[model samples]
Target: MNKVFLLSLYEEAVRVSKPKHCLPQYFNAFSKNDRVCVLGVGKAAADMAVEAHNYFGSNAYGLVVTRYGYENTESTGNIEVRLAAHPVPDENSVTGANALLAAASSVEPSESVIFLISGGGSSLACAPPSTVSLEQKLSLHKFLLRSGASIEEMNTVRKHVSVIKGGRLAAASKGQNTSLVISDVVGDDPAFIASGLTVQDTTTPQDAIAILDKYGFDNASPLRGYLANAPLLPKVKGDYKLVANAQSAIDAAVEMAKASGFSTRVISYTEKGEAQEVAKRHAQIALECKQQGKPILLFSGGELTVTLGDSKGEGGPNQEYLLALTKYLDGEPGICALAADTDGVDGSKDVAGGFIDESTLRNAKRKKIDVNAMLAEHNSFGFFESLESHIKVGPTRTNVNDFRVIYVS
Candidate 1:
C-alpha cells in the first residue's frame, strides 16, 4: 500500500459515481413530451441537467443553480445556468431560488417539474422566508457549520427558516413534481438532501429549535422565533428517485479494490461523528487487518464533522480525518489510507482531501513539520501542502458526500 495504489482506488471510486454514469439510467422512463422543467441544484446540478437535456432534448426546460465556478461551460440549451454561493447563502442564492419558484409557478398543471437535487443546494438556492432576512440566514449558516452539526441537523434548521425549502418549492408549484436527486446525506433521505426541496419534510419547527439548542445556539438567536412560527408544508404527490448516493460510490470502490486482487469489505457507508475519533477507529481497524496477514481493503463513505474549536487553520473534515489517522498509524508499515469529499471540494478549501501512508509521520518528521501541532490548529491543509500530500481534483461536478478507503498489504 502506497500513495499510488491509494490514489488509484480513489479515482475508481469517483469514476463510477460520476453524474454522467449515474444519472442517465434513472431518466429512461421519463417522456420527452411530459413538459418537464428540470430544476438542477448543487455541485452536480449542471452535469445532471446536461444529461437530462440529452434524454429529453428540447422537451426539457428549466434552470440549474450550482456553486460559484461550478457551472458547465458546454452547451446547456433551454436550461438556464446560474452561479450562487455554497455552504453559505448570498444574494445570488436568493435570486436563484426566486427563479426556481417562478419557473415552477408558471408551468401548467399538465406539465411536470423535475428537480435535480444534490448536496450544496441548501445554500446554493437560498430563499429565506420574509420574516428571516438574508443576513440572518447567512449568520445561522456560519454558526451551524462551525458547530459541527451533521448535514441532517443543519438542513433541519435550514428547512424551518426558508421559503423554498422543506417541500415549499414543490408545494408552490402548480405542476406535478419529480426530483432526480444526488444524495449526499446519511440514509439518502431526500428530505435532508438540499433541505428536501421537493420531498415532504417530517421535521417540525420544534425539531429545528431542539437542534439549534443542542448545538448551543443562544435563545436570543433569531432562529428560535422564526422556527417556532414557521409553517410546515404538506407532502405532495411527486416522483422522487435516488439517482446516486454514498453507498454507490463505496460499492464502486470495493469492487475496484477486489478486482485489483485485494480482499475488500465496505464497513459502513453512513459512518459519521467527530473526524478525529472516526480516524482513530479506522486506525484500529487497519491494525486488526494487518494482523490477519492478508492483503485487505476497507472502505467507508459518509460525511464527517470537524468542530473547529478556535484553532482555525485551513482544512476540511477529510483532511482532519487523514491527519488524525496518520498519527494513530504511528509509522506502521503496510497500511495506507485516503479520504476525500466526492464533490471534489473539502470544507471551504479548493483541495479535495488528503492522502496518508504509514510513512506520512516519518516524512513529516524528515521535513521538520510538526504533525501534532498542525492537527491541533486544524491546519491539515497547511501540513499536507508542505509535504505535497494534498489531493486536488477540482470540482467533479457530482457529489455524494465523502469517500474513504484504507489499504493493507
Candidate 2:
C-alpha cells in the first residue's frame, strides 16, 4: 500500500466539507424572507449563517451556536454567532441553549423561520433541564465522551435534558418553520443529528432514561434526578432537508482518487459500532477485496463510538479505529488506509486524524511503541505520532462524521 496516496484520500474527504462546495446547494435553495429568523446550531451553523447572510442580504437575522474553534461567522453582518462547548455542555452551552430557546421565542405564524441544524449541535447548542445545572450537564457530557456511548445513546439522553432539543425548537417555532440540516450521521436521520432540535422526536423521555441505563452511564450524582425529571417537549412537524451527509465525504473521496488515476469504490456510508470491532471487520474486507483481484479503493463514512473502560487515552474514534486495524493487520499484507473525521477534529484533539499501511506496524514497532497497549489505553494519537502519521487540519468548520479510505492496489 502506498501511504502517500492513502493520505491524499483523507485530504480529499476533508476538502469536500468546505463551505463553497457542499454548502452552496443548500444555502442557495433557502430564500430568506424579509421577516425571517435564521437561527442555527452545530459546527457548521455559523458558516451556514454567513452564507445565508450573503445570499439573502440583511434580511436574514438570527443566532447560531458552535464549538469554540468551529465558528465561521467572521463577517456576518446581520447574524449573531455564539461560541459554546461541544461533546460536553458548559456554562457557555447553557447560555447558548437559553439563547436557542430565546431565538425561537419570537416566531409568528406569517414570519418564516429558517432553522439550521447540523452534527455536534446537541452538545454545542444546548439548554439544560430545569432541574440540572450547567456544571452537572458538563460532567455528564464528559462522562459520555469517554463512556463509548453511541451518538444515538448520547443524543437520546440529551433530548430529554435539553429544553430545545427533541422537537422543542420546532415546537418553539410554532408557525411556519423550515430547517436546513447537514447530517453527520448514517442515513442522515434528522432525529439523531443534533438531537432533532428542529424536527419531531418520537423517542420518549423514558427512552432517554433507558439509554443512559443501557450503557451503564448511571453516575450517582445530580443526573439521576435530572433524568427522572426530564424536559417536556411539544409535538411539531416542520419542513426539513438533508443537505450534507457521510455519503458526501465518501463521494468526494471517490472522485478525488479517480481524478488521480486510481480505481475507487465506496464500500459503505453506514458503518457504525465500537471503533475496534468495526476496524477488524473493515480490515478483513480490504484483505478480501485485494485477494479477489478486485484491487481498487474502498471508502466509508459514518460515526463510531469508543467505550472507555477506566483507561487514560488521548484518542478519538477514527484514531482508535486505525490503531485497532493496524495492530491486527500487523503488516500482514500490502494494505494502506486512512481514516479521519471530516470536521478536521477527531474527538476533542487537534488535527483531523491519522492513516496507516503495511509499513505502519514496522514503523511503530521500530519506534518501541506497544501498539496493543496503546489501543488498550485508547492512545492512538501517541502511537501515530511515533509513526509521524497524524493528520492535522485544525477546524474545517463543517462536519459529516468520519471518512475512511482503504486503498487495495
Top lDDT: which candidate number? 1
Candidate 2 residue-wise lDDT at 328: 70
**Candidate with best TM-score:** 1
Separately for all candidates shown, the number of backbone clashes (residues 3 or more apart, or on different chains) is: 0, 4
TM-score of each: 0.97, 0.94
Instruction: For candidate 2, report its TM-score.
Output: 0.94
